[model samples]
Target: MLQPPGALPIRVLVVEDNRDICDNIAAYLEKHNFILDFAYDGISAMHLAVTHAFDVIVLDLTLPGMDGLHFCQKLRTEAKLQTPLLMLTARDTLDDKIKGFEVGADDYLVKPFALQELHVRLHALFKRSNGKAENVLTVGDLTLNKSTLQVHRSGQRIDITPTCMKLLQRLMEVSPSVVTRDTLETLLWADEQPDGDALRSHMYKLRQAIDRSFEQPLIHTVHRIGYRIAEDM
Candidate 1:
């Protein structure tokens, strides 16, 4: 499905062998509300990559089992998955970057990197995946224009925050499927999933902005599960 920009918080698989670095990345990402999954070796990375869907992957060059280059090749050649890859390596050379790209890496970051830069790079990777622009979104009088992040109901435009827009977009895209609270929080917060009642508060705000003003409520609570947007509602 074509998820709107920021519709889901970027899911990142951190494939690094260094325990310290892996923990650091996980901590940083969690602080940002990203649902971070980890793999310390190339084989495991490949397995996770193939089995689960990720918005972007942060791969290390020196991984156990298969190396990053080989893993990238396998992903492109064998798996045929085009998920964006951000390569991380201690080998900061022109040839290294070139080789990574030659395989299938969408972007590269040399080790001893800044946390901020990694964040920016991940953002860039996913934005590029979506052609880096907001256009229009349709989900059964409910229409959204991504460029402006605006929603419409039967031609009536409604103003919404970027967060609400994202929530609605995801719900609409996966209509009828229960979106778990964790999943929705992961999509909205990214590495920064909230604790306590914060997520519930956001959902309330989103419902108020979109569904409260309309008839035939599109957003529905799934009872002990999460939430879903019903086009038929």
Candidate 2:
């Protein structure tokens, strides 16, 4: 990973066993002003995905150790990583494409494809990823921007921790609707159940950060229920 000046550049990991193809891709993309990293097998690709942050990954389906489908599954199910994946495979059948999609590949390209087409597909994938509606909720004089993972309020931005963001997102989603304690915990922790007071501690911090600054507190605790974010006092 080449660390350049200014904001982080979009990183790409190309996983292909063919040295010629890997060299060609690295050379071509480097010319187009992109940071490229190479991994020869699915195991190495999985390691790179887990260790480093990447904007996109060009994965080959038939790889030693773990195969592309299994790798994609691990990234989504185990790592919970959402980096866009462009699958490269010789299996050009409709079934192959369907299976790739089912395994979380953002795009697929058969072998004997042009480098230009690959570039275009990667460009489209990046555009789609950035163009998606990531942020979904906002309250009175408050804004929750998911892209930057930030929360702003009253023309001034308020810093929200990651845990609070999760809690706040749920609160904002069912705005005006009461979020029960059980529901809140399920939404925040999900599968892993924390201590009984864990939710309370997080909620208190979120409310303090969001509501304490403003006169009209937007976060309302509903008795035995949970919480709600409302513009109306």
Candidate 3:
């Protein structure tokens, strides 16, 4: 579905046996608006992974019934899911990480790690799994030409401010996935927060240029969360 980034909650399958670790992960991710499903064992994790489509999966190495290596192997070979998987393990040895990768794990994270780091890693894996970077990013009729730094919708050119162009670039780059307001704000304004509702003002201008004249509005606001560029609301 190309949900590389999201205004929608990033669906994550958390496979871990440790209650404390699961609790911590849940708390942290939920605060960031991530939708999480927990599995205490490898069998349960495999079932959930196979059934649901997730942006990423956090798997623990030491698991009852299946184990992370076996689970990763079965997911790739048996279920045939190419979902991004981040291996979580207490074992930080080179061999342990290599073994994980050999079995189809995309990335690795050691235990006793920062929650923020985990979040960042998951975002990276999700983007990589979908479409890392393309010169032209297209969502339906709307397109952003990175090389020339231009925006177009249905053959019509969109002349916008540099700030608005940056906004459109970002939104189109992560099309189908809603980009959160906080994310957009950070991208535009960085740590120095805008004086007052500057993002909203800019977004209004963007919508006018990109959507107001079009029959089908390509830019959409995702309520209190953020904005996205998609054919569908």
Clashes of each: 10, 0, 2
Per-residue alpha-carbon lDDT of candidate 1 for residues 1-233, written as tens digits (9 for 90 to 100): 22354566779999999999988887776766468899989988877876567889999999899999999998787555678999999999999999999999999998899987887788778878868433676766688775667788888878877677667776765566666776666566655556686777777887887678777777788788888877763
After superposing candidate 1, which stretches have Cα over 4 Å from the reference?
Answer: 1-7, 132-233
Mind giving the per-residue lDDT tens digits that candidate 3 earns over 94-208?
9999999999999999988999999889977876765754678798988888779888888998889999987887677556777778667766765678689999999999999
Can you write out model 2's per-residue Cα lDDT over 49-85, one digit (the tens) per residue?
7656577899999989899999999877655567899
TM-score of each: 0.55, 0.58, 0.55
Which model scores highest in lDDT?
Answer: 3
TM-score of 1: 0.55
Can you rank all candidates by TM-score, best first? 2, 3, 1
Estimate candidate 2's RMSD in Å. Answer: 8.0
Off by over 4 Å in 2: 1-9, 133-233
Name the better of 2 and 3 by lDDT: 3
How good is model 2 by TM-score? 0.58
